[model samples]
Target: MFVSTPRTEASILHADLDSFYASVEQRDDSSLRGRPVIVGGGVVLAASYEAKAFGIRTPMNGRDALRLCPQAVVVHPRFSAYSDASKAVFEIFRDTTPLVEGISIDEAFLDVGGLRRIAGPAADIGQRLRERVRDEVGLPITVGIASTKFLAKVASAVAKPDGLLLVPPGGELKFLHPLPVERLCGVGAVTARKLHDHGIRTIGEMADVGETVLVSMLGGGAGRHLHDLSWARDPRPVHVGRRRRSIGSQRALGRRPKSAEDIDAIVVGIVERLGKRLRAAHRVSRTVVLRMRFDDFTRATRSHTLYESTARNDAILGVARRLVAGATPMIGERGLTLIGLSLTNLENDDAVQLALPFDADANGALDVTIDSLRDRFGTAAVTRAVLLGRDQGMVVPMLPD
Candidate 1:
């Protein structure tokens, strides 16, 4: 059974770029090699491996990161350059498999189940992928081959920077068991603390606790999800053509206490950007999700579903303002460390049968015209009143589609 399982597990491969954005920066700039590089201003967008060694991480405040790695060389992120590199790497991925599901700009799941005859084997494909990414794209990537998405992702994480790891099917338990519970997706700080209180410290310990107990402990949705992942039995397919349901952005404000007006301004900026993206995509969002992270790293998200889907900034910002108000009482003196805005429940405009009875076509047309101007001239050409001065001259971080 064990020998048969090893053969079955080699079909799924997860490819993850090493320290993607920072790596690109290091590769493009010869002077940045072997030194700590931190990208982004006001906050740490992404840090190089050297900076990471000093405990600097993404989404951290720039000041904190600088404090952590005093010798870190800070560089502004070049999204255009990163995008070009990503496109090249993805093109290589397509050459290897017809079924590649991108999880982010830096990582993807490739299903080479039917490529045995041509590609040789999963290990061969992984090696070729690493070589192509290195030789052609000028970047280092890590590849992990396993039977399931969960294990594949875990394997890739284990083989970071530039490496390859393969987990055989029957070896899932052995591969996963000793890992910290935090290694399991969705088990963030809060979840980890909750599980720790229950004496669950590792994936193996979580598995030993039984599914029924976990469900009772963490609620039906998260409990069942984590329990299954603890056993490395994910059944998700490597799907392609998966359109994103949400477009969102977040800014970290550090540990300082921000005034309500300050936070509102940030939210407005996010909503404005989100609205532009929606209009450009010709899609409307039916739901708005507001995520807030506090100084102590505790986070909360509140969402509201609109009666009608629209890409109008007025509509989205209006709801976002209300959601912020609702969350203000929770803010307290600790202040907000991070603010995020996301639009979800998305559908194409063609699917929108008609505009709302209360909405005027004039407003929709105006939005389309504005989007066209911004798209051509750039996002800063046209801006809302709330976003003015709040622009901070910092470019938003781009996420992988």
Candidate 2:
């Protein structure tokens, strides 16, 4: 490869961990290395590259996966271990650069433009980052460096399984034009099929066509977006944040089937935790979203947006319950595997007028009272009537209120 300094420099780096959960399994147990490993039995959580070679994929049914690679070893998910690994990897990212934007626990975008004088070029920083993660965390990670976040992400995908790739600033089109249209973000199976019908297969072909023509073929938003992306005109920045776009919690159920009462208790546990977090952070949300995964390896999401935002547990739970109830038929048909709740459309609690001091119904005083009591004593000290003497699903990652 001819490495050169173009008219402009590549300064954005996208770093992603490879097969995070399965890799963690390999790192801890020597027996799992060099062999195919599958995490999660009912549904695949993560599959090692060796297992992936045999066509095993995450979220696939374990039965189908075993049918493909019967020799593969299946391991239950240890979220605590995975969470610790994610934290360590993220710490390395923060140490590597202050301008780190975490997209997920396992991946981030690092802006290294101003660090050239201090930490060498972006390419050098990326290489050092990979070495540090591999040596310190005992995990293989891939990094891609480019002028734009989109290009950087693409470069990283091209250099997978512990590799580094740098796309020079002026040569982004040269690197992207020949790749399939599916490589572009937002081009799922349906959009790809539509493009395939139009005989447009690569980004270069998209670049050759006019945006107006594309609009005629694929509607306005998709047309304009794809046209700009084909020419490498992405201007979206890597956003850094404290409060996320959404806060959510999920629990996986094994093969055992549960009654409607069992499911409602699970919902209560999730909303109880989320409601406390929302108010503690001084935030309010207008949307309650329910995410469900079925035994058939399919997933569905239902959401309800309230006319007004609230941080009250009863308000949020009312909407969450309705959303879940609406999906009961699908749940019965597909069989339940995982359930989760997320609060979205969030804003500062002050968006609505703060209630007068000690107002119970309007400002959720009872909820606040419960929070204080739990803080003083243990969470088990106070409980809702419905949750009394029941074993709700464990709240992983999030502390109980």
Extract clashing residue pairs from model 2: none
Q: What TM-score, to 2 decimals, does candidate 1 have?
A: 0.90
Check candidate 1 and list the clashing pairs: none
lDDT of 2 by residue, 144-204 (tens): 9998888999999999988999998789999999999999998988888998898999999
Which regions of candidate 1 fall more than 4 Å away from where they truly are? 1-8, 255-261, 332-334, 356-363, 396-401
Error of 2 at 213 (Å): 3.5
Quantify all predictions' global Cα lDDT against the true fold.
Answer: 0.84, 0.86
How many clashing pairs per prediction, in order?
A: 0, 0
Candidate 1 residue lDDT tens string, 224-268 = 999999987777777787778788888777676788888888887
TM-score for all models, in order of appearance = 0.90, 0.84
